[model samples]
Target: MLLEVIEAIRERVGKDYPVWCRLSAMEIGVEGGITLEETQVVAQLAEKASVDAIHVSAHLVGPGRRPPMAQPPGTFVPLAEGIKKVVSVPVIAVSRIPPELGESVLQEGKADFIAIGRGLLADPHMLEKVTSGREEDVAPCICCMTCLDSVTWRDEGIWCVVNAALGREREYELKSAEKPKKVIVVGGGPGGMEAARVASLRGHKVILFDDGDELGGQLLVASKPPFKETIDTFRQYMVGQVAKLGVELRLGERFTVDLLDELKPDAVVLATGVIPFVPQIPGIEGKQVLLVSEVLFGAETGERVVVIGGELVGCETAVYLLQQGKSVTIMMRGPELATNVNPLVRVPLIGRLKTKGASILTGVQYEEITEAGVTVRTETGERRTVEADTVVLAAGARPNTDLLTSVEGKVAQGLPVGDCVKPRGIREAVEEGYRAGLTL
Candidate 1:
């Protein structure tokens, strides 16, 4: 199939464009499907078929199996080197190759070129910065997989936590204002801070306003999760950027449309963020039932807890609870747990959760919340009850669009950005904020 596909493509495109064959080295089963001998045979076959290059990768086809490329400690280089010996064509090797490790792989003659997918995501200009000798300025990828999470959980486009300017390059650009205007941004959150920074960079006098004590908005809640330090880092970067650009920041100030009218600025950006959706379930309003954010940021709960949603938020919260030495059981109406989460991040997380003895019951309809725990009717029509002292509602969130509507006709130019516009993850918030900033 590989050779025939390449031949068909070559016949159609006339071989002007380079055509490379990407093959996975490992498969399921103890012996492995494509051994070193099979890989050499495939490489030789592709070379004989007049292919431009051969990219060798280790692939896994089951749940909880980590991709060979993403395996820790540089285990993929030997396979690439073996494949390189058999084929005269250029060999490309990939697996989470850090820059230092990637350089070593090339220096040691393991492969002609090293491929970095998640690495480049951690820093989009990785190769450019490394080659140009500006390595310090290069933002390091924390490999938290938030970028992958955005694609999986939110069903949105890919984005980097460090590089806020990615994907919205066309929308956000540094342009000198022909006639500079005074801009008063109404929130110091991600979107508001970003707007101020971008507007200031574009030669506009900008004043950022936020009622909150800090500038992160919903990002404050995000910082509490495991492996989510980068979210806080990006938030700090945005705050520092605002100060560096000399944008006037007014913190802890309540913002209203009347204030905007008094200032009479050119534009107003609302990044008020979202409010947690509190469902009207029986026993849900009690003190025992806490929001996921509460558990993430605040005090610990009882020994046994039942999380009421199996989405990414619920799963992570469950993991956090498990880490705190609590036995957690997640009940969801959905078909699977954390189905929206990115495959790259989810594989490892699920493995960890299973090892920690986390229980997941999917496709179960919520009947009510009781003092004992949650009562649910399973997909099989069985009445089941899961007991816990505390019940966490991680179902989802709703947009805080009330402010957006309130300031609709009050401001000359009204722009809605961040989770307030639509409840989403950090990547979407940053991208939305960055684009809003560029537009100003």
Candidate 2:
């Protein structure tokens, strides 16, 4: 049947045309399909049938059983190498193989050719940029899984956290604005920075405002955790891109209706992000109690810390503190922590937290924060207080809509991006900002 398909393709394209067969090396079919040995058998069969080359790939069975290529850079090299050893045909390797890594794979004779997919999504001109000695300009793919998760979770099309113009390339491309409008972006986060970058690239005189002295809003905190160092690179890239594109940045500037009127902009983007959601818990206002942001960006903390809310932020904060030589105990009302995070990021994170000796207690109810620590009761109603010098509120956050609400309808285009629209991650924020910039 495979031979028949090859012949049909050869006939359609003519005998002189090349016909390459792409197949999964390790199929995840329930009843068992193509194993690695079977992959060699298929490759031999295709070779005998006069196929030009063989492209090897693997299927993602489920959450933990990720396809090798999707897992990491050069992840599929071993699989491709194994297949290449058994096949006479020129082998093509794929899946997250960037140019630099691909060059290494070729030098090692892993495959005859390297094909990149997601790498291109980050920077369409990645090859051109790298080859032209502009390696710094080539946006890197951190394998954050936002592109795939966006499709599965949001029912939305593709979006790159690093490149906002992934799917909407034509729509969000840097075309000169028809009318050179004045743009005021109220926020120095990823979303606001992206809006200003695109708007500025399109010839709009753009200015960005953020209340905090520093840019990168949630990203500032998100980048501080372990195994999340790439987020810092991403933040640096976005901030640098906006700066290079000439977005006038006003740090430590609070946005107001009065300030908005002072700017007198034709377009306004409110990417004010979110404020920490401090629950009305007993003793939440204690001196020892602090928000996650405070622990990360502001407050000086004690050696022992109790983190409330075992969601992504809570778990990550616990990990961060643990690395800081602070003992951490995280309490959660749910059955598990970081359930909302993609498995790629969550699994390793949980593993690292365990390795670092961070305590995670789930299916627990928060009673109150005490001077010593936080009191939590299990499902059985037995209360136990975890001792700590600091109580970090990693619970969650609420959208900051003060500026958006105040200046809504006052501008020609009043756009809300990032956490203002919804408290999602970098992907949603950047995408919304880029699309909104296109409209302006």
Q: Identify the leading candidate in terms of TM-score.
A: 2
The whole-model C-alpha lDDT of candidate 1 against the native structure comes to 0.77
| Ten-residue stretch with the least lDDT total in model 1 | 62-71
How many residue pairs clash (N, CA or C atoms closer than 3 angstroms) in each of the candidate models, in the order given? 1, 0
Error of 2 at 129 (Å): 3.6
Query: Over the stretch 333-414, how does candidate 2's per-residue lDDT look in tens digits?
Result: 8898899987656666677678789888888888888897888898678999899899998888889888777787788889
Record all residue pairs in model 1 with backbone atoms less than 3 Å apart, i.e. clashing.
69-95
How many angstroms is residue 239 displaced in model 1 relative to the true structure, after the best TM-score fit?
4.9
TM-score of 1: 0.75
**What's the lDDT of the predicted structure labeled candidate 2?**
0.82
TM-score of each: 0.75, 0.81
